[model samples]
Target: MNASPSHQPHPAEWTETQSLLPCVERDLPAGRHQFHKEQLMARIHEDLRTTTRPEPPKRRPNPFLRRTVLLPAAALALAGAVAGGFALSSGDPHGGRTALATGPALTTTVGAADAEGAPRLLDRISLAAADTSTPTPRKGQYIYIESKVASTYTSSVGDKTSVVSEELHPRQVWNSLDGKDGWLIEPGQTGDEGITLASEVVMSGAYDVLATLPTDPDALLRRIYRESDATRDHEVPRDQAAFTAIGDLLTESYPPADVSAALYKAAAKIPGVVAVDDAVDATGRHGVAIAREDGTGERTEWIFDKKTLRFLGERVVVVKAVAGSPFKVGTVVFTSAITQRAVVDANKQVPGGAS
Candidate 1:
């Protein structure tokens, strides 16, 4: 009965049957038949009038991205702070002190006792000791005297030995005894031969000779002392000729004020001078007034022996130059030979001579 029905199937059934056949064949070749099956399925779908489904909207990343980035940044900042704190807390290898917030205060004190009384006493003692120790000729007095100078001199002519002897009269203005009024014998005119020449010389040639009558030796001595004191204070050139004349008569005298001051200044500049004592040259004793200069020559100090107040001596230490060279070339020692004897009578004026 089914075979009889199949011989005369309906048109609809036939079409369905044909569709089923093609689908079976497509199933056998899925890679090649997918497009055709899809076309047919699209046609069926179009015929069915199905509603279209809307697509979901695209989404963006979370808004917390800024916070995410800042988290790591914050971590890095904390790490840097920790490291910096460690560095500051650690002690420095070098010996550097911590900075101070404020500076220290300064203070000073003054008194009349220091400025007037004590200083004066000390000065008096110093002066007295100096006067007694050195043979300084009385000031302002004229004297006839002789000196034996021991010196080695080299001249263009050659080396020679010289003996200098003369009669010296100190004048307020005259510094040397070699001039016309000064008493120095010319070469070959010394001894008895110079007696006639000495007589012929005029007293007018004398320099700084005072014309005061009834010679006041004290006044003359005072004038000399005052001049010498002024010279010492003001730093005037030590008139060598004047000093020599005075020294010849008195034995020793202070260098001019200027020279003494210069020596002080120089001593101060020396690197190692710790103290300076006054110069001294009198009574056959010779030494500087000030004993300064440290042994090492790097620092200096001013020194005065409280008891003696006289400069005894200085100890100098060696110092090397920047280039490691020797700094000092030589050492100089200054000595003096002065006496405390009056060589001439204060009231005795030279015959036919102006005071």
Candidate 2:
């Protein structure tokens, strides 16, 4: 239950979030974030203008820069909406803009999810995670991750209503071991110069904190549930919160091999977790997935490299269609693919310093 919520980045400004400055995917309390999201979503009633909006069904959620999980299912429906929906829709609602192409929101065919295959797949995923190698960020070092992502959300112009998708764009983050100093560069969320990830930095998103967690699956599960209790939305089942929290951890931060393995193994213990054979990450790479549908109308899928079982990224898709809702089944609301992650020596310094 990483309880630090102040320094979190929720999906960029949408209808409800228009007043707040745009940031990346968030991992804050479900009560506040969910309340804000569901309240605004409930207001959607007008039919989407065919000229600007897609037919429906979208995805995204979040990762790398772990923020409170939510969106394009407004974060789950893709950043957990197309970024938590890839964003609550990237950036300002009025412009509905980003470096990604702007037009109709992104949609996709519904991939099949299998409950029976989940556990076995998770087992293999756990082994692969255990064998995976990651650089350790020491003191005076920074954890850097780069992702290609987008968001989906309902928008309006004059009297016309439409769902807009930010063209896919790159999101970069730099976090120090202390979580007190960092920077973020995402077109819709920040300026080209980016913003400091300070003042709001929390231990929850720091690599050092992840290294200290218990590696035993059962014990780790207990720890996650216990920490999540304070922030859990009363409407959400604890199991779902635990699962989403784990998704945020896996997608957004660099975890130790043992801890990563434990997280996967623990995911197997949760009820309702499933597997999808036909899944794709934000990078357009196809692979298997481990997913779960929360109380929200969307499902979150963690994608993996098919051959090596290496984690690629995650996406959110609408599993259940809501009446009059802007999104439909199979809509990819938010999506993110990690193109690079490593231990860098300075804030804002990229891997290989190429970008």
User: Using TM-score as the measure, which candidate wins?
Assistant: 2
Candidate 1 per-residue C-alpha lDDT over 252-288 given as tens digits, one digit per residue, 9 for 90 to 100: 1122222222223322222222222322221112222
What is the number of residue pairs that collide in model 2? Answer: 77
What is candidate 1's CA lDDT for residue 158? 40
What local lDDT score does residue 215 receive in model 2, on the 0 to 100 scale? 94
TM-score of each: 0.23, 0.75
Which residue ranges in model 2 land beyond 4 Å of their true spot?
A: 1-101
**Candidate 2 residue-wise lDDT, 124-199, digit = tens:** 8888777756656678988776666666765676777777766667777666775546666666444456645443
Evaluated at residue 28, the lDDT of candidate 2 is 22
**Top model number, lDDT:** 2
